[model samples]
Target: MSGLAILLLAAGASSRMAGRDKLSEEVDGQPLLSLMCRRAALTGLPVYVTVPSDAHPRTGLTGTATTVPVPDAAEGMAASIRRGIAALPANTEGVMIVPADMPDLETQDLMHVAAHFHGGDGPILRATSENGQAGHPVLFPKRSFDDLCELSGDQGARALLKRDKVQYIALPARHAITDLDTPEAWAAWRAANG
Candidate 1:
Protein backbone atom coordinates (compact mmCIF):
# COMPACT_ATOMS: atom_id res chain seq x y z
CA MET A 1 0.00 0.00 0.00
CA SER A 2 1.08 3.59 -0.51
CA GLY A 3 2.38 5.48 2.50
CA LEU A 4 0.19 7.83 4.54
CA ALA A 5 0.26 11.60 4.02
CA ILE A 6 2.05 13.50 6.81
CA LEU A 7 0.85 16.57 8.70
CA LEU A 8 3.81 18.55 10.09
CA LEU A 9 2.40 20.50 13.05
CA ALA A 10 4.44 23.73 13.23
CA ALA A 11 1.91 26.33 14.21
CA GLY A 12 2.28 26.20 17.98
CA ALA A 13 2.72 29.53 19.84
CA SER A 14 6.05 28.33 21.28
CA SER A 15 5.50 30.31 24.47
CA ARG A 16 7.92 28.01 26.27
CA MET A 17 10.70 28.76 23.81
CA ALA A 18 11.13 32.12 25.54
CA GLY A 19 10.26 34.29 22.53
CA ARG A 20 12.07 31.98 20.12
CA ASP A 21 10.31 29.98 17.42
CA LYS A 22 11.51 26.40 17.59
CA LEU A 23 10.63 25.84 13.93
CA SER A 24 13.01 28.59 12.86
CA GLU A 25 15.76 27.34 15.15
CA GLU A 26 18.80 25.82 13.47
CA VAL A 27 19.53 22.13 13.65
CA ASP A 28 22.73 21.18 11.83
CA GLY A 29 22.62 24.45 9.86
CA GLN A 30 19.04 23.92 8.61
CA PRO A 31 15.82 25.30 10.05
CA LEU A 32 13.99 22.74 12.18
CA LEU A 33 10.85 22.95 10.08
CA SER A 34 12.84 22.61 6.87
CA LEU A 35 14.58 19.50 8.12
CA MET A 36 11.25 17.99 9.19
CA CYS A 37 9.72 18.70 5.79
CA ARG A 38 12.67 17.02 4.09
CA ARG A 39 12.34 14.01 6.36
CA ALA A 40 8.61 13.71 5.72
CA ALA A 41 9.17 14.07 1.97
CA LEU A 42 11.34 10.98 1.99
CA THR A 43 8.22 8.81 2.23
CA GLY A 44 7.32 10.18 -1.23
CA LEU A 45 4.00 11.36 0.14
CA PRO A 46 2.81 14.93 -0.01
CA VAL A 47 3.35 16.74 3.31
CA TYR A 48 1.41 19.65 4.82
CA VAL A 49 2.50 22.14 7.48
CA THR A 50 0.31 24.21 9.77
CA VAL A 51 2.07 27.46 10.55
CA PRO A 52 1.36 31.05 11.46
CA SER A 53 0.66 33.36 8.53
CA ASP A 54 3.64 35.53 9.40
CA ALA A 55 6.10 32.64 9.62
CA HIS A 56 9.36 33.21 7.76
CA PRO A 57 9.59 31.78 4.27
CA ARG A 58 13.24 30.93 4.83
CA THR A 59 12.10 27.82 6.68
CA GLY A 60 12.11 26.14 3.23
CA LEU A 61 8.57 24.86 3.75
CA THR A 62 6.68 27.40 1.68
CA GLY A 63 6.20 25.27 -1.45
CA THR A 64 7.02 21.77 -0.27
CA ALA A 65 4.83 21.45 2.79
CA THR A 66 1.67 23.24 1.80
CA THR A 67 1.42 25.95 4.46
CA VAL A 68 -1.99 26.03 6.10
CA PRO A 69 -2.34 29.13 8.22
CA VAL A 70 -3.79 28.75 11.70
CA PRO A 71 -5.22 32.12 12.71
CA ASP A 72 -6.00 30.91 16.23
CA ALA A 73 -2.71 29.15 16.69
CA ALA A 74 -2.17 30.93 19.98
CA GLU A 75 -5.07 28.88 21.31
CA GLY A 76 -3.05 25.65 21.06
CA MET A 77 -1.62 22.70 19.11
CA ALA A 78 -4.94 21.09 18.24
CA ALA A 79 -5.74 24.04 16.02
CA SER A 80 -2.80 23.14 13.86
CA ILE A 81 -4.08 19.58 13.49
CA ARG A 82 -7.53 20.85 12.63
CA ARG A 83 -6.13 23.14 9.96
CA GLY A 84 -3.86 20.44 8.62
CA ILE A 85 -6.71 17.94 8.34
CA ALA A 86 -8.83 20.55 6.59
CA ALA A 87 -6.06 21.22 4.09
CA LEU A 88 -5.47 17.58 3.23
CA PRO A 89 -6.06 16.53 -0.33
CA ALA A 90 -9.36 14.84 -1.07
CA ASN A 91 -7.58 11.65 -2.02
CA THR A 92 -5.59 11.40 1.21
CA GLU A 93 -5.84 7.76 2.29
CA GLY A 94 -4.76 8.48 5.85
CA VAL A 95 -2.71 11.03 7.77
CA MET A 96 0.54 10.44 9.65
CA ILE A 97 0.71 13.33 12.08
CA VAL A 98 4.07 14.59 13.35
CA PRO A 99 5.15 17.79 15.04
CA ALA A 100 7.77 19.87 13.23
CA ASP A 101 9.87 20.09 16.40
CA MET A 102 10.69 16.39 16.13
CA PRO A 103 13.38 16.98 13.55
CA ASP A 104 15.37 13.90 14.49
CA LEU A 105 12.68 11.49 13.26
CA GLU A 106 13.88 9.57 10.25
CA THR A 107 11.81 8.69 7.19
CA GLN A 108 12.00 4.98 7.94
CA ASP A 109 10.22 5.40 11.28
CA LEU A 110 7.36 7.15 9.51
CA MET A 111 7.15 4.39 6.94
CA HIS A 112 7.02 1.89 9.77
CA VAL A 113 3.82 3.49 11.02
CA ALA A 114 2.28 3.62 7.55
CA ALA A 115 3.12 0.01 6.93
CA HIS A 116 1.00 -1.05 9.90
CA PHE A 117 -2.10 0.65 8.55
CA HIS A 118 -4.17 -1.52 6.27
CA GLY A 119 -7.75 -2.01 5.21
CA GLY A 120 -9.96 -3.17 8.12
CA ASP A 121 -7.03 -3.07 10.53
CA GLY A 122 -8.64 -0.22 12.48
CA PRO A 123 -8.45 3.53 11.89
CA ILE A 124 -6.19 4.65 14.72
CA LEU A 125 -2.60 3.48 14.67
CA ARG A 126 0.33 4.92 16.68
CA ALA A 127 4.05 4.35 17.07
CA THR A 128 5.38 3.27 20.44
CA SER A 129 8.79 3.90 21.92
CA GLU A 130 11.27 1.06 22.51
CA ASN A 131 10.04 0.55 26.08
CA GLY A 132 6.37 0.48 25.07
CA GLN A 133 5.56 4.15 25.44
CA ALA A 134 3.08 5.71 23.01
CA GLY A 135 4.24 8.67 20.92
CA HIS A 136 3.47 11.01 18.11
CA PRO A 137 3.46 10.73 14.26
CA VAL A 138 0.27 8.71 14.70
CA LEU A 139 -1.51 7.29 11.67
CA PHE A 140 -5.19 8.14 11.54
CA PRO A 141 -7.11 6.27 8.91
CA LYS A 142 -9.95 8.01 7.11
CA ARG A 143 -12.48 6.73 9.61
CA SER A 144 -11.67 9.53 12.05
CA PHE A 145 -12.09 12.45 9.68
CA ASP A 146 -14.95 14.00 11.62
CA ASP A 147 -13.17 13.74 14.96
CA LEU A 148 -10.00 15.23 13.52
CA CYS A 149 -11.91 18.18 12.09
CA GLU A 150 -13.61 18.87 15.41
CA LEU A 151 -10.37 19.24 17.36
CA SER A 152 -9.62 22.55 19.09
CA GLY A 153 -7.58 24.18 21.86
CA ASP A 154 -4.59 22.27 23.27
CA GLN A 155 -6.35 18.92 23.21
CA GLY A 156 -4.99 17.05 20.19
CA ALA A 157 -5.93 13.57 19.02
CA ARG A 158 -5.98 12.29 22.58
CA ALA A 159 -9.74 11.98 22.47
CA LEU A 160 -9.88 9.87 19.36
CA LEU A 161 -7.52 7.27 20.79
CA LYS A 162 -10.05 6.54 23.54
CA ARG A 163 -12.57 5.12 21.08
CA ASP A 164 -11.42 1.52 21.70
CA LYS A 165 -10.70 0.70 18.06
CA VAL A 166 -7.21 2.17 18.18
CA GLN A 167 -4.27 -0.13 17.47
CA TYR A 168 -0.60 0.24 18.31
CA ILE A 169 2.64 -0.33 16.43
CA ALA A 170 5.89 -0.13 18.32
CA LEU A 171 8.60 1.63 16.29
CA PRO A 172 11.39 1.24 18.86
CA ALA A 173 13.01 4.65 18.31
CA ARG A 174 13.08 7.16 21.16
CA HIS A 175 12.96 9.98 18.63
CA ALA A 176 9.39 8.94 17.93
CA ILE A 177 8.30 10.64 21.17
CA THR A 178 10.94 13.35 21.38
CA ASP A 179 9.62 16.88 20.75
CA LEU A 180 11.49 20.11 21.50
CA ASP A 181 9.14 21.79 23.90
CA THR A 182 11.71 23.43 26.23
CA PRO A 183 15.36 24.36 26.29
CA GLU A 184 16.13 21.65 28.82
CA ALA A 185 14.38 18.86 26.86
CA TRP A 186 15.94 20.12 23.65
CA ALA A 187 19.41 20.04 25.14
CA ALA A 188 18.81 16.61 26.68
CA TRP A 189 17.43 15.20 23.43
CA ARG A 190 20.40 16.49 21.45
CA ALA A 191 22.89 15.21 23.98
CA ALA A 192 21.26 11.80 24.47
CA ASN A 193 19.84 10.93 21.05
CA GLY A 194 21.40 13.14 18.41
Candidate 2:
Protein backbone atom coordinates (compact mmCIF):
# COMPACT_ATOMS: atom_id res chain seq x y z
CA MET A 1 0.00 0.00 0.00
CA SER A 2 1.11 3.57 -0.66
CA GLY A 3 -0.48 4.61 2.65
CA LEU A 4 -2.84 6.45 0.34
CA ALA A 5 -6.58 6.41 -0.28
CA ILE A 6 -8.73 7.52 -3.21
CA LEU A 7 -11.64 9.84 -2.70
CA LEU A 8 -14.09 9.68 -5.60
CA LEU A 9 -16.42 12.69 -5.46
CA ALA A 10 -19.83 11.63 -6.74
CA ALA A 11 -22.16 13.71 -4.58
CA GLY A 12 -22.71 16.46 -7.14
CA ALA A 13 -26.29 17.06 -8.25
CA SER A 14 -25.26 17.23 -11.90
CA SER A 15 -27.66 20.13 -12.25
CA ARG A 16 -25.88 21.12 -15.44
CA MET A 17 -27.07 17.88 -17.05
CA ALA A 18 -30.69 18.92 -16.46
CA GLY A 19 -32.49 15.90 -14.96
CA ARG A 20 -29.73 13.48 -15.79
CA ASP A 21 -27.52 12.21 -12.98
CA LYS A 22 -24.16 12.29 -14.72
CA LEU A 23 -22.65 9.87 -12.20
CA SER A 24 -25.27 7.30 -13.15
CA GLU A 25 -24.69 7.78 -16.85
CA GLU A 26 -23.47 4.75 -18.79
CA VAL A 27 -19.81 4.45 -19.61
CA ASP A 28 -18.86 1.35 -21.61
CA GLY A 29 -21.86 -0.56 -20.23
CA GLN A 30 -21.32 0.42 -16.58
CA PRO A 31 -22.29 3.49 -14.57
CA LEU A 32 -19.67 6.20 -14.64
CA LEU A 33 -19.56 6.08 -10.85
CA SER A 34 -19.03 2.32 -10.92
CA LEU A 35 -16.28 2.57 -13.48
CA MET A 36 -14.53 5.26 -11.47
CA CYS A 37 -14.80 3.26 -8.27
CA ARG A 38 -13.43 0.17 -9.95
CA ARG A 39 -10.57 2.13 -11.40
CA ALA A 40 -9.77 3.65 -8.04
CA ALA A 41 -9.93 0.26 -6.36
CA LEU A 42 -7.53 -1.18 -8.92
CA THR A 43 -4.84 1.03 -7.47
CA GLY A 44 -5.10 -1.19 -4.36
CA LEU A 45 -5.93 1.88 -2.28
CA PRO A 46 -8.99 2.40 -0.14
CA VAL A 47 -11.70 4.43 -1.90
CA TYR A 48 -14.39 6.59 -0.36
CA VAL A 49 -17.32 7.59 -2.55
CA THR A 50 -19.61 10.43 -1.56
CA VAL A 51 -23.26 10.48 -2.63
CA PRO A 52 -26.27 12.69 -1.94
CA SER A 53 -27.71 10.09 0.45
CA ASP A 54 -27.45 6.44 1.29
CA ALA A 55 -30.63 5.86 -0.73
CA HIS A 56 -29.30 7.55 -3.82
CA PRO A 57 -28.71 5.27 -6.81
CA ARG A 58 -25.00 6.00 -6.68
CA THR A 59 -24.75 4.22 -3.34
CA GLY A 60 -25.82 0.99 -4.98
CA LEU A 61 -23.07 1.15 -7.60
CA THR A 62 -20.16 1.85 -5.25
CA GLY A 63 -19.02 -1.81 -5.31
CA THR A 64 -15.90 -2.17 -3.12
CA ALA A 65 -15.49 1.53 -2.38
CA THR A 66 -16.90 2.89 0.87
CA THR A 67 -20.07 5.01 0.56
CA VAL A 68 -20.23 8.35 2.38
CA PRO A 69 -23.54 10.16 2.11
CA VAL A 70 -23.35 13.92 2.28
CA PRO A 71 -26.67 15.20 3.55
CA ASP A 72 -25.54 18.71 2.68
CA ALA A 73 -24.24 17.70 -0.72
CA ALA A 74 -26.44 20.42 -2.26
CA GLU A 75 -24.15 22.86 -0.51
CA GLY A 76 -21.67 21.83 -3.22
CA MET A 77 -18.24 20.22 -3.64
CA ALA A 78 -16.92 21.09 -0.21
CA ALA A 79 -19.63 19.15 1.55
CA SER A 80 -18.60 16.02 -0.26
CA ILE A 81 -14.92 16.81 0.09
CA ARG A 82 -15.23 17.36 3.81
CA ARG A 83 -17.28 14.23 4.24
CA GLY A 84 -15.12 12.06 2.01
CA ILE A 85 -11.91 13.05 3.70
CA ALA A 86 -13.35 12.17 7.08
CA ALA A 87 -14.36 8.76 5.80
CA LEU A 88 -10.89 7.67 4.69
CA PRO A 89 -9.20 4.89 6.65
CA ALA A 90 -7.21 5.72 9.78
CA ASN A 91 -4.00 4.57 8.12
CA THR A 92 -4.29 6.84 5.10
CA GLU A 93 -1.28 9.08 4.71
CA GLY A 94 -2.36 10.81 1.49
CA VAL A 95 -5.46 11.17 -0.63
CA MET A 96 -6.05 11.31 -4.37
CA ILE A 97 -9.18 13.32 -5.00
CA VAL A 98 -10.86 12.22 -8.24
CA PRO A 99 -14.06 13.64 -9.68
CA ALA A 100 -16.35 10.78 -10.76
CA ASP A 101 -17.54 12.43 -13.96
CA MET A 102 -14.33 12.17 -15.94
CA PRO A 103 -14.99 9.21 -18.21
CA ASP A 104 -11.66 9.53 -19.97
CA LEU A 105 -9.75 8.92 -16.74
CA GLU A 106 -8.77 5.27 -16.94
CA THR A 107 -7.28 2.99 -14.27
CA GLN A 108 -3.84 3.75 -15.65
CA ASP A 109 -4.41 7.48 -15.25
CA LEU A 110 -5.14 6.99 -11.55
CA MET A 111 -2.19 4.64 -11.08
CA HIS A 112 0.03 7.24 -12.71
CA VAL A 113 -0.92 9.69 -9.99
CA ALA A 114 -0.64 7.18 -7.16
CA ALA A 115 2.79 6.18 -8.32
CA HIS A 116 4.03 9.69 -7.64
CA PHE A 117 2.82 9.93 -4.06
CA HIS A 118 5.92 9.49 -1.87
CA GLY A 119 5.15 8.26 1.64
CA GLY A 120 2.44 10.89 2.27
CA ASP A 121 4.93 13.76 2.66
CA GLY A 122 6.05 16.07 -0.08
CA PRO A 123 4.57 18.66 -2.42
CA ILE A 124 1.03 18.06 -3.56
CA LEU A 125 0.77 16.07 -6.80
CA ARG A 126 -1.72 17.51 -9.27
CA ALA A 127 -2.41 15.90 -12.61
CA THR A 128 -1.92 18.18 -15.60
CA SER A 129 -2.71 17.93 -19.28
CA GLU A 130 0.10 16.88 -21.61
CA ASN A 131 0.26 20.56 -22.55
CA GLY A 132 0.63 21.49 -18.86
CA GLN A 133 -2.90 22.55 -17.97
CA ALA A 134 -3.57 21.96 -14.23
CA GLY A 135 -6.48 19.62 -13.58
CA HIS A 136 -8.02 16.84 -11.54
CA PRO A 137 -6.99 13.80 -9.38
CA VAL A 138 -4.91 15.97 -7.03
CA LEU A 139 -2.83 14.05 -4.47
CA PHE A 140 -2.54 15.78 -1.14
CA PRO A 141 -0.34 14.81 1.78
CA LYS A 142 -1.67 14.21 5.29
CA ARG A 143 -0.60 17.71 6.37
CA SER A 144 -3.23 19.26 4.07
CA PHE A 145 -6.21 17.20 5.13
CA ASP A 146 -7.48 19.88 7.49
CA ASP A 147 -7.44 22.49 4.76
CA LEU A 148 -9.28 20.20 2.39
CA CYS A 149 -11.92 19.50 5.03
CA GLU A 150 -12.34 23.23 5.52
CA LEU A 151 -13.16 23.92 1.87
CA SER A 152 -16.55 25.38 0.98
CA GLY A 153 -18.95 25.89 -1.92
CA ASP A 154 -18.49 24.30 -5.36
CA GLN A 155 -14.95 25.46 -5.95
CA GLY A 156 -13.56 22.18 -4.61
CA ALA A 157 -9.95 22.56 -3.41
CA ARG A 158 -8.81 25.31 -5.76
CA ALA A 159 -8.26 27.69 -2.87
CA LEU A 160 -6.20 25.26 -0.79
CA LEU A 161 -4.15 24.32 -3.88
CA LYS A 162 -3.22 27.92 -4.52
CA ARG A 163 -1.71 28.19 -1.04
CA ASP A 164 0.34 25.02 -1.31
CA LYS A 165 3.29 23.86 -3.38
CA VAL A 166 1.88 21.72 -6.22
CA GLN A 167 4.00 19.53 -8.47
CA TYR A 168 2.29 18.85 -11.77
CA ILE A 169 2.36 15.37 -13.33
CA ALA A 170 1.50 15.31 -17.01
CA LEU A 171 -1.09 12.84 -18.24
CA PRO A 172 -1.89 12.17 -21.90
CA ALA A 173 -3.76 14.82 -23.89
CA ARG A 174 -6.56 16.50 -21.92
CA HIS A 175 -7.23 13.47 -19.76
CA ALA A 176 -6.59 15.50 -16.63
CA ILE A 177 -9.08 18.22 -17.54
CA THR A 178 -11.75 16.30 -19.42
CA ASP A 179 -14.66 16.32 -16.99
CA LEU A 180 -18.09 15.87 -18.63
CA ASP A 181 -20.84 17.76 -16.83
CA THR A 182 -23.46 18.68 -19.39
CA PRO A 183 -25.22 16.63 -22.05
CA GLU A 184 -23.47 18.64 -24.75
CA ALA A 185 -20.08 17.87 -23.20
CA TRP A 186 -20.86 14.14 -23.06
CA ALA A 187 -22.01 14.21 -26.68
CA ALA A 188 -18.92 16.08 -27.82
CA TRP A 189 -16.58 13.80 -25.85
CA ARG A 190 -18.31 10.73 -27.25
CA ALA A 191 -18.11 12.07 -30.79
CA ALA A 192 -14.52 13.25 -30.54
CA ASN A 193 -13.15 10.13 -28.81
CA GLY A 194 -15.33 7.45 -30.36
Candidate 3:
Protein backbone atom coordinates (compact mmCIF):
# COMPACT_ATOMS: atom_id res chain seq x y z
CA MET A 1 0.00 0.00 0.00
CA SER A 2 1.28 3.45 -0.94
CA GLY A 3 0.18 5.07 2.29
CA LEU A 4 0.10 8.79 2.89
CA ALA A 5 3.45 10.19 4.00
CA ILE A 6 3.29 12.35 7.16
CA LEU A 7 5.08 15.72 7.17
CA LEU A 8 5.61 16.72 10.80
CA LEU A 9 6.01 20.49 10.87
CA ALA A 10 8.48 21.50 13.63
CA ALA A 11 10.02 24.65 12.19
CA GLY A 12 8.15 27.24 14.24
CA ALA A 13 10.18 29.73 16.32
CA SER A 14 7.83 29.42 19.32
CA SER A 15 7.95 33.13 20.10
CA ARG A 16 5.27 32.64 22.72
CA MET A 17 7.46 30.18 24.60
CA ALA A 18 9.95 33.06 24.99
CA GLY A 19 13.32 31.55 24.05
CA ARG A 20 12.25 27.94 24.62
CA ASP A 21 11.89 25.59 21.64
CA LYS A 22 8.60 23.88 22.31
CA LEU A 23 9.28 20.98 19.95
CA SER A 24 12.37 20.02 21.97
CA GLU A 25 10.60 20.35 25.30
CA GLU A 26 10.24 17.10 27.22
CA VAL A 27 6.94 15.48 27.92
CA ASP A 28 7.32 12.42 30.18
CA GLY A 29 11.08 12.29 29.51
CA GLN A 30 10.67 12.38 25.72
CA PRO A 31 11.13 15.29 23.38
CA LEU A 32 7.81 16.40 21.91
CA LEU A 33 9.14 15.98 18.39
CA SER A 34 10.52 12.54 19.13
CA LEU A 35 7.32 11.35 20.75
CA MET A 36 5.24 12.70 17.91
CA CYS A 37 7.56 11.05 15.39
CA ARG A 38 7.54 7.78 17.28
CA ARG A 39 3.78 7.87 17.53
CA ALA A 40 3.43 8.54 13.82
CA ALA A 41 5.91 5.77 13.05
CA LEU A 42 3.61 3.29 14.80
CA THR A 43 1.24 3.45 11.85
CA GLY A 44 3.93 1.99 9.58
CA LEU A 45 3.88 5.17 7.56
CA PRO A 46 6.95 7.10 6.41
CA VAL A 47 7.19 9.97 8.91
CA TYR A 48 9.58 12.87 8.37
CA VAL A 49 9.98 16.01 10.49
CA THR A 50 10.96 19.47 9.25
CA VAL A 51 13.14 21.10 11.92
CA PRO A 52 15.20 24.27 11.96
CA SER A 53 18.91 23.76 11.24
CA ASP A 54 20.01 24.96 14.68
CA ALA A 55 17.69 22.88 16.85
CA HIS A 56 19.15 21.75 20.15
CA PRO A 57 20.96 18.43 20.49
CA ARG A 58 18.20 16.02 21.41
CA THR A 59 19.05 12.32 21.43
CA GLY A 60 15.51 11.05 21.72
CA LEU A 61 15.19 10.51 17.99
CA THR A 62 18.85 10.78 17.00
CA GLY A 63 18.88 8.26 14.18
CA THR A 64 15.39 9.14 12.98
CA ALA A 65 14.98 10.61 9.48
CA THR A 66 14.36 14.34 9.15
CA THR A 67 14.64 17.37 6.83
CA VAL A 68 16.56 20.43 7.94
CA PRO A 69 15.90 24.17 7.86
CA VAL A 70 12.91 25.34 5.93
CA PRO A 71 14.40 28.60 4.53
CA ASP A 72 11.07 30.40 4.52
CA ALA A 73 9.77 29.02 7.82
CA ALA A 74 10.02 32.46 9.34
CA GLU A 75 7.40 33.44 6.80
CA GLY A 76 5.14 30.87 8.52
CA MET A 77 3.72 27.33 8.24
CA ALA A 78 2.77 27.46 4.57
CA ALA A 79 6.47 27.58 3.75
CA SER A 80 7.14 24.50 5.84
CA ILE A 81 4.35 22.69 4.01
CA ARG A 82 5.84 23.74 0.69
CA ARG A 83 9.34 22.64 1.68
CA GLY A 84 8.02 19.27 2.88
CA ILE A 85 6.06 18.78 -0.31
CA ALA A 86 9.13 19.62 -2.38
CA ALA A 87 11.18 17.02 -0.52
CA LEU A 88 8.60 14.23 -0.80
CA PRO A 89 9.49 10.97 -2.55
CA ALA A 90 8.28 10.51 -6.11
CA ASN A 91 6.08 7.63 -5.00
CA THR A 92 4.26 9.75 -2.41
CA GLU A 93 0.79 9.77 -3.85
CA GLY A 94 -0.49 12.16 -1.15
CA VAL A 95 0.43 13.57 2.26
CA MET A 96 -0.85 14.16 5.80
CA ILE A 97 0.22 17.56 7.16
CA VAL A 98 0.69 17.61 10.94
CA PRO A 99 1.99 20.16 13.39
CA ALA A 100 4.80 19.13 15.76
CA ASP A 101 3.06 20.42 18.86
CA MET A 102 0.18 17.97 18.91
CA PRO A 103 1.65 15.75 21.60
CA ASP A 104 -1.57 13.97 22.36
CA LEU A 105 -2.43 12.81 18.83
CA GLU A 106 -2.76 9.02 18.89
CA THR A 107 -1.88 6.40 16.31
CA GLN A 108 -5.52 5.40 15.98
CA ASP A 109 -6.41 9.00 15.05
CA LEU A 110 -3.76 9.01 12.35
CA MET A 111 -4.94 5.65 11.10
CA HIS A 112 -8.48 6.98 10.93
CA VAL A 113 -7.38 9.96 8.85
CA ALA A 114 -5.29 7.82 6.51
CA ALA A 115 -8.04 5.24 6.11
CA HIS A 116 -10.37 8.00 4.98
CA PHE A 117 -7.83 8.96 2.35
CA HIS A 118 -7.20 5.38 1.24
CA GLY A 119 -10.92 4.77 0.86
CA GLY A 120 -10.79 6.89 -2.32
CA ASP A 121 -13.95 8.71 -1.37
CA GLY A 122 -12.74 12.15 -0.47
CA PRO A 123 -10.49 14.62 -2.25
CA ILE A 124 -9.58 16.20 1.10
CA LEU A 125 -9.95 14.45 4.45
CA ARG A 126 -9.95 16.53 7.63
CA ALA A 127 -9.92 15.25 11.20
CA THR A 128 -12.22 17.07 13.57
CA SER A 129 -12.71 16.91 17.29
CA GLU A 130 -15.88 15.20 18.44
CA ASN A 131 -17.27 18.64 19.20
CA GLY A 132 -17.05 19.54 15.49
CA GLN A 133 -13.88 21.67 15.56
CA ALA A 134 -11.70 20.85 12.53
CA GLY A 135 -7.97 20.44 12.92
CA HIS A 136 -4.58 19.34 11.62
CA PRO A 137 -3.01 16.15 10.29
CA VAL A 138 -5.35 16.80 7.39
CA LEU A 139 -5.03 14.57 4.33
CA PHE A 140 -4.78 16.17 0.93
CA PRO A 141 -5.15 14.48 -2.42
CA LYS A 142 -2.09 14.65 -4.69
CA ARG A 143 -3.86 17.17 -6.86
CA SER A 144 -3.53 19.88 -4.17
CA PHE A 145 0.27 19.82 -4.29
CA ASP A 146 0.50 22.75 -6.69
CA ASP A 147 -1.77 25.01 -4.66
CA LEU A 148 -0.14 23.97 -1.39
CA CYS A 149 3.32 24.80 -2.74
CA GLU A 150 2.18 28.17 -4.04
CA LEU A 151 0.78 29.23 -0.68
CA SER A 152 2.62 31.96 1.26
CA GLY A 153 2.76 33.79 4.59
CA ASP A 154 0.77 32.40 7.59
CA GLN A 155 -2.06 30.94 5.54
CA GLY A 156 -1.18 27.29 6.19
CA ALA A 157 -3.99 25.50 4.30
CA ARG A 158 -6.96 27.20 5.93
CA ALA A 159 -8.15 28.34 2.52
CA LEU A 160 -8.12 24.81 1.22
CA LEU A 161 -10.51 23.77 4.02
CA LYS A 162 -13.02 26.24 2.64
CA ARG A 163 -13.08 24.50 -0.69
CA ASP A 164 -16.23 22.61 -1.61
CA LYS A 165 -14.57 19.22 -1.95
CA VAL A 166 -13.28 19.00 1.62
CA GLN A 167 -14.80 16.24 3.82
CA TYR A 168 -14.29 15.55 7.51
CA ILE A 169 -13.87 12.58 9.87
CA ALA A 170 -14.62 13.40 13.47
CA LEU A 171 -12.07 12.02 15.90
CA PRO A 172 -12.98 11.37 19.52
CA ALA A 173 -9.65 12.68 20.77
CA ARG A 174 -9.53 16.25 22.05
CA HIS A 175 -5.87 16.47 21.08
CA ALA A 176 -7.00 17.21 17.57
CA ILE A 177 -6.90 20.99 18.23
CA THR A 178 -4.67 21.32 21.30
CA ASP A 179 -1.05 22.47 21.13
CA LEU A 180 1.47 23.94 23.54
CA ASP A 181 2.31 27.45 22.41
CA THR A 182 2.59 29.74 25.42
CA PRO A 183 4.14 28.57 28.68
CA GLU A 184 0.76 28.76 30.38
CA ALA A 185 -0.87 26.67 27.67
CA TRP A 186 1.95 24.19 27.91
CA ALA A 187 1.66 23.91 31.68
CA ALA A 188 -2.09 23.68 31.48
CA TRP A 189 -2.02 20.94 28.86
CA ARG A 190 0.61 19.06 30.81
CA ALA A 191 -1.45 19.27 33.96
CA ALA A 192 -4.62 18.25 32.19
CA ASN A 193 -3.12 15.36 30.31
CA GLY A 194 -1.15 14.10 33.26
**Which parts of model 3 have CA positions greater than 4 angstroms off?**
54-63, 118-121
- Residue 92 miss distance in model 1 (angstroms): 1.4
TM-score against native, each model: 0.90, 0.97, 0.91
Query: By TM-score, who's the top model here?
Result: 2
Question: Tens-digit lDDT track for model 3 on 1-194?
Answer: 26478888888789999888788789779878888888888888888777655454532352365655676679999888888888888777778888989887888888888887753234888888889898877888788888888989887998877873887888886768887898898989878878
lDDT per residue for candidate 2 within 30-96, as digits (tens), equals: 9989989998888888889999999988899999989999999999999999998888877789999
What overall lDDT goes with each candidate model? 0.78, 0.90, 0.79
| Tens digit of per-residue lDDT, candidate 1, span 114-193 | 88887433668887788878887788887787788898778787887886476777765676787888878777777885
Candidate 1: pairs in clash: none
Better candidate number, 2 or 3, judged by lDDT: 2
